[model samples]
Structure formats: C-alpha cells, structure tokens
Target: MSKEILTTKDLHLYYGDKEALKGINLNFDAKGITALIGPSGCGKSTYLRTLNRMNDLIPNVTITGTIKFKGQDLYAPSADTVQIRKEIGMVFQQPNPFPFSIYDNVIYGLRIAGEKDKEKLDAVVEKSLRQAAVWDEVKDHLHESALALSGGQQQRVCIARVLAVSPEIILLDEPTSALDPVSSSQIETTLLNLRHDYTIITVTHNLQQASRIADRTAFFMNGELVEVDQTKNIFMNPAEKQTEDYISGRFG
Candidate 1:
C-alpha cells in the first residue's frame, strides 16, 4: 500500500465570519495525484491551501480541527510554516515566473535559502528543468529573461522552480486554465511523469482533465466534501446523487 503522507480530520476554515471550508477529512497518498473538482468558490482551492497553511497568511482567518503531515499536527503553534511551504510548494493558475534569467528563476528558492555553491545550483537547475520537461528547449537560453518565454514555457519554468526546492508535495490551483490546449497537455504529461517522485494535489474546474490525470477524485460542493474515490468510480459510478448530477452536467 502507498504511504499516507498527509491527512486532515474534520478540518474547518473561516474568513472572519464566513465559513470557507466545512469539516473536511482526507488522506493523501505519497507519490500520487489527487484531483479536487468543484465549481468556483466551492472550497476546493481553500482546502488545498490548508494543506500547507497558506490560509494562515490572510488576516482574520480561523482554522480548526487537525491537518497532519506524516502523523504530525500541521497546525501546531510550534509547527514551522516556512518549512511546511518549502516541502509543499504551490503553483498558481497563471504563470508567474520572476523577471530574471531562466537559470536564475529555476534556482531562486535555493538562493533564498542561502545556497551559494554554483556547481550544486547548476546541477539542481538542470535536474529540475529536465524533470519539468523543459530542459532541451531552453538549455541554450538559460541566461535569457524568463519573461520572454511563451506562457506554457513560463509555467514549466515555475514548475521547475518548485522542483528545485525539492518539495515532497505539489499543490496546483487550476494550473492549466490559462494555457492553450497543447500547452495544457504538455503540463499534464509532465505531471504524470512527476508522480513517481512527489505527491500532487490539483484543484481544477475541468472535469475531463480530472478524469484523465487524477488517480483519485474528490468532489466538493458548497464547502463540503461530497465524495472521494478512485477516478473511474467517481466518474462512472459515483456514490452520491449530487456527485452524479455534477459529473453529468446536471448541476455544478
């Protein structure tokens, strides 16, 4: 059986008086991809942020219950939020590469962490770009400005940047929503190859994409987890009528 790397028990979150996430319980497997699917503002993204305590940055935000990483409480007062984020990196919907050279963008995190060894940084940059499936195309232009790259290439560079930090888990929030179909496919392919090394949780509004790439799918609606199961089962034989309705496009 795959190891359970992260888990939540009755997890809840609020922004001031508005509840964003109701009680959410989930167990995420190591080195696997789990997709969160729901309509906009249904709490899928909110829950994803909770995994790495990203919600803590918001003022007046309140969280309750337990989020555990390898059986350790993630919300503990003494828990290191910075460390959690380093281990669980996030890639957003739009590509947001820094206005730096391609090589510099990939090694940005390492530099912040005080790594000064050029040889080691070079090795990590190469490995990360290779893993993100964008090495060959940009290898000759490593010193070129990252902003000059196409949207898809920039997104892959962001992925490489995350990989260089050696994150154990990757959180993607509608990562392909802004890209063209071909670019989206490339990102999906890269993610598939990456599942052997990192746990990935992606929140997507695209139902078909979830079916195509997710090993397991969790359906959320109105701040609640409707159901979670194998991708095939969730798509072909959902246990809840609400899930079936949403999947069939009856309602979102």
Candidate 2:
C-alpha cells in the first residue's frame, strides 16, 4: 500500500448559507492518481479546491473540517495558505496562462516569490517545460506570447508553470474538458508520467478518461462520497448500488 499524503476528515464546505460539501473523509494516496467522478454539481470541484483553500477566495464560504497533509493540520491558524497552495498545485477546467511570453508565464510564480536570479529561472523554466513534455516543442519560441499557443499547448504551458513551482501534489479539475482529442491524449500521457513524482487528484466528468488514468476512483453524489475503491473494482464490481448505477449508464 502507498503512503497517505493528504487526508480530509469530515470536510464540510458552504457557499454563503448553502452547503456544498457534506462531511467528506477521504485519503489521497501518495504518488498515485485518484479520480473523482460524478454528475454535474456533485461537489467534486468543491472538494478539490478545499485541499489548498481555494474556496477561501470566495466571500462567506465556510469550511469546517481538518485537512491534514502528512498528519499536520492544514487549516490551522499557523498554517500558511500560500505555502499550502505551492505544495498542492491546481489546474483548472479551462487553460488559463498569464498573458506573457511562454517563458515569462512559467517564471511568473518564481518572480512573484521574489526570485530575481536569471540563470536559475531559465534553468527551471526549461526543466519544467520538459517535465510537462512541451520543452522541445516550445524551446525555440519561448519568447512568444503564451496566448498565441494552441489551446492544448497553452494547457501544457499551464502544467509546466505548475511544475516549475515543484508542488508535491497536483489537483486537476477536469483539465481535459476543453481540449481536442489529440491534445487531451497528450495531457493524459503527461499526467501518467507525472504520477512518478507527485500525487494527483482529479475531478473529471469524462468516465472514459477517469478509467484510463486513475489508479483509484471515487464516486460523489449530491455532495456526498458514495464509494471509493480501485479502478477495476469501482468499474467492474462496485460495492455500492449507486456506484453500479452510475457506471452502467443508468444515471450520473
């Protein structure tokens, strides 16, 4: 069994007075891909954002629970939200790169963190692009505006930017939902390879994509986690009736 990197203990989230997450307790495996699947508006995205306190950006969004990273409470008063986000990187449903040169886009985070060393920035930019599998393709055009890249390449650049930050975990919220098939496949391959270095938690509505890359699958419904198990078991022999119904095309 792999080590548990992050654990959510009865997580509850609320947007204003409306509850979004209902006491979720789940352990994310270190160096493995855990896919969260469910119908639309099932709180998969909400749960993903809570890992790094992204929900805190919204006013009146209340979170009541302990999220532990390596057994340390992440919601503690002393816990640094910025550092937590750095350690737990996130990719959104849409490819959103900074409107700057490709190189600048990847180095933006470093610049914000007050890194002024040019040589170090250049080296990390090259290395992270390669890690994201787009270095060779974009090396000659690093100065080009990031927005000029194709949607898939832009998404890859976003990945490179996150990789450059050296996060221990990557949280993806339907990352491939906006890409073409080829681009989506490339990102999938990149994600598969990234698992060797970081734990991945993804919320994808695409059942096929979840089946392809997830080592374990979690089913959520109406803000509740219904079932979680290995990919094979979840798809072939789910322990819960709702899981079976969802997987067999009966319902979301």
73-166: candidate 2 lDDT, tens digit per residue: 9989999998998999999989999999999999988989999999999999999999898998899999999999999999999999999989
Residue pairs with clashing backbones, model 2: none
**Using lDDT as the measure, which candidate wins?**
1
The regions of model 1 sitting more than 4 angstroms off are: none
C-alpha RMSD values across all candidates: 1.1, 1.3
Clashing pairs in 1: none
- Weakest 10 consecutive residues of candidate 1 by summed lDDT: 1-10
> How does each model score on lDDT?
0.94, 0.93
How many residue pairs clash (N, CA or C atoms closer than 3 angstroms) in each of the candidate models, in the order given? Answer: 0, 0
Q: Write the per-residue lDDT of candidate 1 for residues 17-82, one digit (tens) a residue.
A: 999999998889898899999888999999999998888778999999998888789999899999
Worst 10 residues of 2 by lDDT: 1-10
